[model samples]
Target: MSDTPCRVAVCWLLPELEQPARDLAARLQLPVATADSIEAELLLRLGGDGLSLQATGADAPGAVRVDFVEGALAHRRQFGGGAGQMVAKAVGLRGAVRPTVLDATAGLGRDAFVLASLGCEVTLIERQPIIAALLEDGLQRAREAGGEVAEIAERMTLIQGDAITFMAQWAAAAPQVIHLDPMFPHREKSALVKKEMRLFRPLAGDDLDAPALLAAAWALASHRVAVKRPRKAPSIDGPPPSAQLSGQSSRYDIYGKKKLG
Candidate 1:
């Protein structure tokens, strides 16, 4: 089916956020409202705190927002193994070589931000408009925060579009690593499924084209392609991965094209 999030509306909670809300409403062809309580399954809310995707209904999941300066991301940046985390090693982050990365399935940009915080220039492509908008807001806030957060945010560039076409037609400086975290069915009992994903599943729908995404990543990355999968999940339908780095809950399957310094 369509690979876009459904039932999205644009709204503003602050006067300063009104212009951007209206602008996004016009671009996305969605209704604009001052209150998020308006009739809509999902709301793209703009406020002084930044953009957040909120869901309605009594049992709705918690709101999804990107905040690089605090919360889980901050804790991970501080405590998670630097350049030694499974993802770091999977992307070929050796002593002197922190390869530039292109994250093709940047849903909320957590991994990409991690790579950036470690010194890799990262370009993110999020196909879903709602998620992309949230990422952009987070990046903007990070930039305004200054210091290391700003530096890290500066390393990230968000490009909202279909990554398959983007990789195929790319003519700019090609990234050394292409990362794929295509959506997979979240096992009900698995701790890997976050609340944000509860809302994301309904918006992003099923990821029926992950195989194609993997193929695109394979053809484009100069050094390697890394696919993040659940530890016990089956591999994508394609060439076998050259190597695998496993963590407690997730797996990184690396398809090497060439060696990175």
Candidate 2:
């Protein structure tokens, strides 16, 4: 009965381990609906240590299923060095700056995970409660995913609030670089995009207000702000990028500001 339309329906696929789940849900401010057929905008699978989610399309926020933390850790390892460079670009907003990072739009938390993997303390800010719940569940799983990098995954922090609000409160520690990866509408709707993007599109909706997000990020980022856009698409507001990293279909626009020591 909250303003948020998406309801997190955790069907008991496994036995109930209520404390951690409930505690995590509370921490993330996600709505834990008791009814089985409450017409959830999203359906979340609450495991012992993590969560998996699929947008039900009625009112879900984004379509992403983060395997438990260990699963995520494996995925991170597989993502390999390309992801490492993405994290580097994020870190480089400060130009050799190793300042704390605030990932303003943490979709599936992939970028945040990468930043943490690269040894940067990451604070993830997500507005939607359901998405935050999935992230929390994923983080918990990552903690259990034992390997050389488990400790680095543990360094991530989740804050259940609007990025703008969090940035305002922590103005003093304004992140050296604020990373923004707002969801863009799929341009060429084909089987590939559908297979890969259908679920996420309904869940995240179109971030029509991405420009506002850019403005807020600029205000909060101390050294610079980097936005990931489809290679075909233009820059967020203008073409003032200090540098551009292009891929097959996406690009990273780095907007550098102050210099770092």
Candidate 3:
């Protein structure tokens, strides 16, 4: 993704959220308008479902929203394999050791949420303003929902800044684990990719600095750095992972800095 901040505007379909939308517009230094009038590449939509993104184009799909409490995240929390899952194991979540994790990429905050649900304190870093806003709104609504999901959301922190810069400044206070899930160029057809990916790819672009991100993670993580990759994709360009943990559709390339206690 580009290091430069993304340009976006706040749009509202529901009348009740207009003031809040205006407030966000002011904070983001963007204009407030309806989706149809939005001139920016990304439109932040405040609707009943929550904060979503609407890409401006002739062939763009409908607004895509982030819902932590009621969709895939909730399903995973309810029925996912918990600490036994691949990502959990990759982050060294075994026994009573719940390592603090910094998710460098934090796209949509899915893996971060999973780690948080498994009892890790996860700090999520998303550089893109639009994605960060959506993640922030999702976390807030999840917190207000007030249940297990809310409790999990409590352990998750969202940081709106470049991960590489954040890690560079975090050398002394590095977390036990740093997770990287940089977006790769999608080779599949647009119809084949997930809706969220379709929407996000246009906004975030390919993560061209992924190798640099890994290097920064190595410098910051006290214990290990775990990278998520498509099962069939090649390893990120850098030193080889110390080990790997694989699932059906994805794999975790683990670079060990120190063993987890």
Candidate 4:
């Protein structure tokens, strides 16, 4: 990962978010400053649009933010097929039982949100402090928004720490399905990558410790472990998956320790 620190602060135009911004900065140990004041490689701005990241010298038109109440997340919640989507199938969501999921690598809480929308209780673990803060803020706003979105947000939990350590300590009380979506090295051109990917790649880097995470999942998950990877990327180094669910851009390698209901 780049040694450059990500400068984060609230957007000056939205003074109401300043307190929360300061709280976030304290939690992440990041310095708070105006967008133009810092000579940072990346600036994470918290405001009405939620938390967004912008490259200081990039020519991008807008910032990348995580908004669970609207945009892609809202669209997916409203229209996304429930318990029958590829992710649901990968998590073995069938019959009447909705497996409790431990999303070990909950980058933006996208997958975990999907699972929660499908009736599964999801615990999201994001090791990166900044990403976790963004996700937590989004969830908080989602809960206050009320209605179906709030209900789904209620089923999701967020934690900030290393997944391997968390799972190692919580193995005895582990959830039935443990989900892993470790970051992989993508070869796409910088400009061509999605804004979110472009912003997150520099912060989280590749998951060099994924194999260790997978092993810990195996030890903790009672029923199965699901690993999400690029469509053609090889599975994480460890025991082979028992089944596979393929999607257009990605695939789920399912390691079943026991039969699902």
lDDT of each: 0.88, 0.67, 0.86, 0.83
Question: Ten-residue segment with the worst summed lDDT in candidate 2?
Answer: 190-199
For 88-185, candidate 3 gives per-residue lDDT tens digits of: 99999989999999999998998999999989999999998778989999999999999888999999999999899998887356799999998877
Model 4 gets an lDDT of 0.83
Model 2 C-alpha lDDT versus the unseen true structure? 0.67
Kindly list the per-residue Cα lDDT of model 4 for residues 38-92, writing each as its tens digit. Answer: 5666667776767777776657546766678899988888888877888899999
1-261, model 1: which lDDT tens digit per residue? 154446778888888778888998898778876543558888888877888988877888788899999999999999988998888999999898999999999999999999999999999999887788889889999999999999999999999988998999999988999999988875677664577877788777657888999998888889999999988888999999999988888899999999999
Predicted structure with the largest lDDT when compared to the true one: 1
Query: After TM-score superposition, what is the CA distance of residue 51 in candidate 4 from its true location, in Å?
Result: 2.5
- Assess the local accuracy of residue 16 in candidate 1 as a C-alpha lDDT between 0 and 100: 78
* Candidates ranked, most accurate by TM-score first: 1, 4, 3, 2
Between candidates 2 and 3, which one is better according to lDDT? 3
* Clashes within 3 Å, all models in order: 0, 8, 0, 0
The regions of model 3 sitting more than 4 angstroms off are: 3-8, 35-41, 56-59, 188-192
Candidate 4 to native Cα RMSD, angstroms? 2.2
